[model samples]
Target: MLKIGPIFNYLQDMADKDASRMEMSIPQLMEKGYTWVLHRYHLSMIRYPKLDEALSIRTWHSPYKNLYSLRAFEMTTSFGEVLAKATTSWIIINYSTKRPMRLDRHVTSQYYKEIIPFEFDFSSLSPLERIDLEDIYPVRIRDLDINNHVNNAVYVEWAAETVPTNILQSMRPSEIDVIFKEQLTYGEKAVVQTQKEKTASNVFDHVILRESDAREITRIRTSWKNMPL
Candidate 1:
């Protein structure tokens, strides 16, 4: 019962562990009133690994700019079969002041820089259309991170909740690209607008907005494939 949810959760976990050992750990950053915030996440899956499969993930990092860094992960089976590729972009900001922090060269230099990263192009995704599915998701206490905002990774679940039940039952999402636009607090509710288009693939595009003013929250485009395992 592997789901896309775990794809991100596990990847984030591994990144934290590896970074901690290299001195860029989350705990260390929080002490300075600075923490990384995920702005983009893109994942492409060649196949889903079974529960019994023994998999390994190799990660590459790049310091994209003075304020932001990029990381990519390649998931593979023990036998060398590639399962998926994931890339994310993050920025460090002081939560209290809500200002972006300058890059710490000492930290960025620790990760190997040669691994190529998959670039995300938002313009290529289908434009937002009439809402086919709209729902309100409550922000749970557990979803809040040290930043006191909803964890960016949980936004995937909010978007996935709007997927049509029929599609969820028949297809598995093989690709996902998301952009985080706004932050949500504990009592706030996320109103999601989702549309499914038929082309070469069933492309689902979602526009998550704040209920109060209809301000954009997040944008996600997901493409699904038949269960090919």
Candidate 2:
């Protein structure tokens, strides 16, 4: 089965392609001293594609809300089976100041189209109340993206690392919600704290913190399903 990290990269790549079609690619934005940063993601998977399987991914953006933009994605198999659907929120920030910038009228009115691929609330996700397991991983240069911060997909992989071995082997994530709080850089250590939900045995909540200051970097919730026999 495909892992969440690779799936996330695929979705991001599709979004980049869509942006490029609109002449809003990362390099284009960078030339203007601005770049898009992901704020939140909600991904729900029906089934992961198998190796060598062909799939189609479609992505589109809705009208911007001030400095934020909402992008939606859908992945389908060749037979037209829906494999996954995702919604992401992003903010355009000035590269020098690192502060969010207002969406330009042309960018908002001309580029964005109102499209509802799937309905999902962008509300804040609940945090982990207690820690059932914890692990630490040192950030590596390879973990950083072009932005010089930890890649968004790495957070999901970090959260998954805290899962119990038995659950990892027997179950697959069906839904994942994530909120990125702060950036993590190379040489930093990430402490991943996780808790299994009491009410939902197959659900887990995770918080990634900077080991040095204990500052929260990301929050994630994952719901798992038993794999087929």
lDDT, candidate 1, residue 6?
80
Model 1, residue 62: what's the lDDT?
A: 70
- Candidate 1 lDDT tens digits, 58-115: 8766767666678888899999999999888888777688677877543555554343
lDDT of 2 by residue, 1-229 (tens): 6788999999998888888777777777888888888999999999888888999998877645566678999999999999999999888888889888877632534364544444559646787788899999999999998788999999999898899988888888889999988899999999999999999878899999999999999999988998542
Scored by TM-score, the top model is: 2
Q: How accurate is candidate 1 locally (lDDT)?
A: 0.79
lDDT of candidates 1 onward, in order: 0.79, 0.85
TM-score of each: 0.88, 0.93
List the lowest-lDDT window of 10 residues for candidate 2: 105-114
Task: Judge candidate 2 at residue 227 and give its lDDT.
Answer: 56
- In model 1, pairs of residues that clash are none
TM-score of candidate 2 versus the correct structure, residues matched by position: 0.93
- What overall lDDT, based on C-alpha atoms, would model 2 receive against the true structure? 0.85
